[model samples]
Target: MIKLIGVALIAAGFALRVNTLLVVLAAGLATGFAAGFSLNEIMAMIGKYFTDNRAMTLPIVLMLPVVGLLERYGLKERAEVLIRRSKAATAGRVILLYTAVRQISISLGVSIGGHAGAVRPLVAPMAEAAARGRGGELSAASVVSIRAHAAAGENIGNFFGEDIFIAVGAILLMKGFFEAQGMNVSVWAMALWGIPTAFIAFAAMWWRCQMLDRRIERTAADNAKAGGVQ
Candidate 1:
């Protein structure tokens, strides 16, 4: 029963909305102490874990500084400028392209496609700029719609594309499950099949974005007419 103190700590920390990193570390330490480990042993275990995974986390650590530097120096403005000049590019189209880029990048193990790191600072603002250029002006609702579409694109693309990588955890789990059931499955087969599925999903999402663009344009036109009539 006392062994569950670690889990309890996690629940309490989360419920209290404490700093997540501190909470998790505290929970682990508490759990280790409760489970009969000395403080030194617990500290050693934590160090060992980080050591074992050092290479894996190094890239993430490197990316944080790089992303921060970009934001500090106006990467968002650069992204907006790049998107605004393309006459045929709408908010939805710009984001859709970002979705594709993010998916491909994520499949290769780079995860710069997140909401805070990529979407908000780069993708969303560029999308807003693109839309405002097309329609001459943008309402708050239009801005929200553009950002929402960018977020949705990042989410959907990342969700479906990552599983296609043979070395990804999900495909490995699938391989293990099939083998346990006395059926043979190959990782290569999963990767091969995932390509077409990803393409289909991307096309479907692209079509939906196009529809949203049309709807936003119509709403803008309707609002204009109503204002003129008043």
Candidate 2:
């Protein structure tokens, strides 16, 4: 029961909204001491784990500063301008194109976009521009809905596409899990199986994009009517 002080520390840290990485490290140190590990032993264990697993998080940490630099240079504004200048651009069309690009790039193991790296600072603004077009701005509800759809498009594209890449984290995880369960599975086979699923996901989302176009237009019309009546 005394060893559970670590759990309380974790809970308190989160409640206080402390930096998550700091909180976790603090709780782990506390738990190690509680478990009767010496300071040297705890440090050794932490060093070992960090060496083994830091690859997973290091790229994201390194990229954050670069992403911030780009955003500060008006990446989002440029994306909006480019899309708005193209008369053919529409919210649904832009999202659909992005879905295809995302899926293809992920399949090749090229992580070209993420919610933070791409969506917030580029995709979302481009999508909003398309929704607004040359017409009056989209209603608040319409803007939110289009952004949600754009985000979903990115997610669906990534989820299904990465499975097609044998070296992707999810497929490696699946392979490891199955191997642990004493089942021999091939990473290539799993990737092959993901092909049909990827196609199905694209088809389904394409249909949904069509529906999204109609929905955005209808929402705009309703907002216009409400304003006129006022």
lDDT of 2 by residue, 1-230 (tens): 97998899999999999999999999989999999999999999899867655545565577778767877898656755755565657788888888887999899876767787677777778778877873467767777877898899999999989999876667776876686589999989999999998999999989988898888888778778778312
TM-score of each: 0.63, 0.64
- Prediction RMSDs, each to the true structure: 5.7, 5.3
What is the C-alpha lDDT profile of model 1 across 1-230, one tens digit per residue? 98888899899999999999999999999889989999999999999866754545556576788878876898756755765566646877888888887788777765655798778877887777777676657766777778888889999789778877776656766776686589999888987788888888799889978976887787678767777312
The segments of candidate 1 whose C-alpha lies over 4 angstroms from its true place after superposition are 1-4, 34-36, 61-88, 109-122, 133-136, 155-208, 228-230
TM for candidate 2 is 0.64
lDDT, candidate 1, equals: 0.78
Query: Which stretches of model 2 miss by more than 4 angstroms?
Result: 1-88, 224-230
